[model samples]
Target chain A: DQQVKQNSPSLSVQEGRISILNCDYTNSMFDYFLWYKKYPAEGPTFLISISSIKDKNEDGRFTVFLNKSAKHLSLHIVPSQPGDSAVYFCAALVTDSWGKFQFGAGTQVVVTP
Target chain B: NAGVTQTPKFRILKIGQSMTLQCAQDMNHNYMYWYRQDPGMGLKLIYYSVGAGITDKGEVPNGYNVSRSTTEDFPLRLELAAPSQTSVYFCASSSSEAGNTEAFFGQGTRLTVV
Candidate 1:
């Protein structure tokens, strides 16, 4: 069963516009949520994370919002740039597991000029 | 610091063949993990170790084994290869701390099984 799901397989946005990626989870036990970005032939790099205690976390151009009651989370990048084009994976830390993480299928975001 | 390094960036194996995917980290992290990413799929944890002499299975642990004899090295072993096991494998490490759960990943190892 896929506890974490990224319904959209891919997303596209024009450069200098808003690009939002969404993720939903069925497991209520997950307390920590994270987003990672990956380029071709490279490993997934950590972007940002939000603890269950906080509803939102921001890092410069990147921001993550969590809605525990809705079981949803999102990553928003304003004024998306060409360099932002890549595969994004949403992950959650399993509560019972010892720092083990579960990831979503991923959403391929394309930022065009 | 080289961070996390994984040897054999690519490999191919026939049925019943066995090989070791070696991973080493320079961060001196006490926690290490091995995960596989199928095409168009998310990463699934195979095995992880909090420290040497300790290993545990994760979401997907079939047809795989791992040993962490040292703090810097964690090798994943495939006893018998299968087509289903063909995927990109990643090795990650992090210090065993609450605020440091963010992981550092290696370049990744692409394995193809026939």
Candidate 2:
């Protein structure tokens, strides 16, 4: 079973606009959520994360919002730049199980110049 | 420093053949994992190691084996290659520490079986 799901396989947005990537999870036991960005032929890099206790976390141009009640979380990139185009994967950490992580299929975002 | 290095970035194997995929991490991480990604699908864990001499299977461990002889190296072995095994494999490492659970992945190895 896929505990984490990214329904949208692809997304497109204009440069200098907002780009939002959504993720949903079925396992309520997951408390830590993370977002990773990957480029073509490269490994994924950590972007940002939030805990179950917090509703939102922000870093510069990127922000992650978590809604525990809805079992959903999203990554928001404001004033999106061309360089932001890549595949984004949402992951949840299962700390109790020796820190095992569950990841979504991923969403490919294209920022138009 | 090379955080996580996976050798043979790309490979093609014939059905019934066998080979091993090498993975090493310079970060001295206690937790190492092997994952495979199929087309249009998320990564599935094949195997994982907590430290030297301790290993366990993950979501999709069939047709694959792993050995963790040292903390710095973890290798995956395919006993009998199959066409369904063709996919991109990724090696990742992370710390079990409270604040450093973020995983670092290697570039990945694309394996094709024909």
Candidate 3:
């Protein structure tokens, strides 16, 4: 069974606009969540993350919000640039699971000029 | 630094064949993991190792095996290739230190079974 789900398969937005990607999880044991950005033929790269203790975490143009009670999280990239067009995956980690990560299907974001 | 390295970026195997996907890391991380990504599906964990000489199965460990003989190497073995095993494999490593939950990944190895 998939513990993490990214219902949206794709998203398109104008450059310099905000791009939002949402994810949900069914396992409440997940205490930490992360976002990874992947380019074609490349491995996923860490983008941003939020601990369950906090509701939001921001780094420059990227922000991650976590709602533990709702078992949901979202990634926001403001002023989306052409380079931001890629597949984004949301992953959840349980504290004692030896760092095993449960990843969502992924959301393909396209930034249009 | 070469954070994580995977060999045979692309390989094609016949059914019933067996091969090993090599992985190495120079970061000296204590935790290493193997994951496979299928078309339109998210990455699924195959196996993981906490340290040298220690290994454990993950969500999708069937038809696969792994060995962690040293901190720098974690190799995945496909005992019998199958059509369903055709996918992109990724090797990742991360430090177990507190406040460092992110994992560094290799470029990935694409394997096709026919």
Candidate 4:
């Protein structure tokens, strides 16, 4: 069974707009949530992460919001740029689980200029 | 710095063939993992090691094996290649120390089993 899920398989956004990608997880034990961006034929790179203790975390143009009560998390990109076009994956992990991450089906984001 | 390195960016194998996927990291991370990504599916963990000589199976361990002989190297072995084992394989490493939660991944190896 897939513990993490990204309901949207793909999203298209205009440049300079806000892009939101959402994820839901069934496991309540997960306390660390992260987002990764992947370009074609490349490995996924870490974008941002949020700890369960905090509701939101931000870095530059990217922000991750976690709603532990709802078992949902969302990643937002402000002023989305064409360079941000890639597949974004949501992952969660329990700190004690040997750092094994449970990944969600990635959401492909296309930023149109 | 080479965060993580995987050998043979691509490979093709006939049925019943066996091969080892090589992975190395220079970050000295104690945790290493092998994961497979299928078309339109999320990455599923195959095996992982917390330190040298300590390996454990993850969600998907069938037809796969792994060994961690050193902090920098983790190799995955496929005993008998099957069509179902065809997928993109990724090797990642992370430190279990406090405040280091992110994992560094290699470019990945695309494997095709005939």
Compared with the true structure, what per-residue lDDT tens digits does model 3 show for residues A51-94? 89999999999999998889999999998999999999999999
Candidate 1 lDDT over residue span B30-74, tens digit each: 889999999989999999999999999988999999999999999
lDDT of 4 by residue, A22-102 (tens): 999999999999999999889989999999999999999999999998999999999899999999999999998889999
lDDT of 1 by residue, A1-113 (tens): 99999999999999999999999999999998999999999999999999999999999989999999999999999889999999999999864467888899999999999
* lDDT comparing candidate 3 with the true structure: 0.96
Q: Could you list the iRMS of every candidate?
A: 1.2, 0.8, 0.6, 0.4
Candidate 1 chain A TM-score vs. reference chain A: 0.97
Point to the candidate with the largest DockQ: 4
Question: lDDT (0-100) at residue A27 of candidate 2?
Answer: 98
Best-to-worst DockQ order: 4, 3, 2, 1
Better of 2 and 4 by lDDT: 4
The alpha-carbon deviation from the true structure for residue A57 of candidate 2, after best TM-score superposition, in angstroms, is 1.0
Q: What local lDDT score does residue A69 receive in model 4, on the 0 to 100 scale?
A: 87
Kindly list the per-residue Cα lDDT of model 4 for residues B21-99, writing each as its tens digit. Answer: 9999999899999999999999999999999999999999999999888999999999999999999999999999987
| Per-model TM-score versus the true fold | 0.97, 0.98, 0.99, 0.99
CAPRI class of candidate 3: high
After superposition, candidate 4 runs with Cα above 4 Å error: none
Residue B86 displacement in candidate 4 (angstroms): 0.8
Worst 10 residues of 2 chain A by lDDT: A93-102
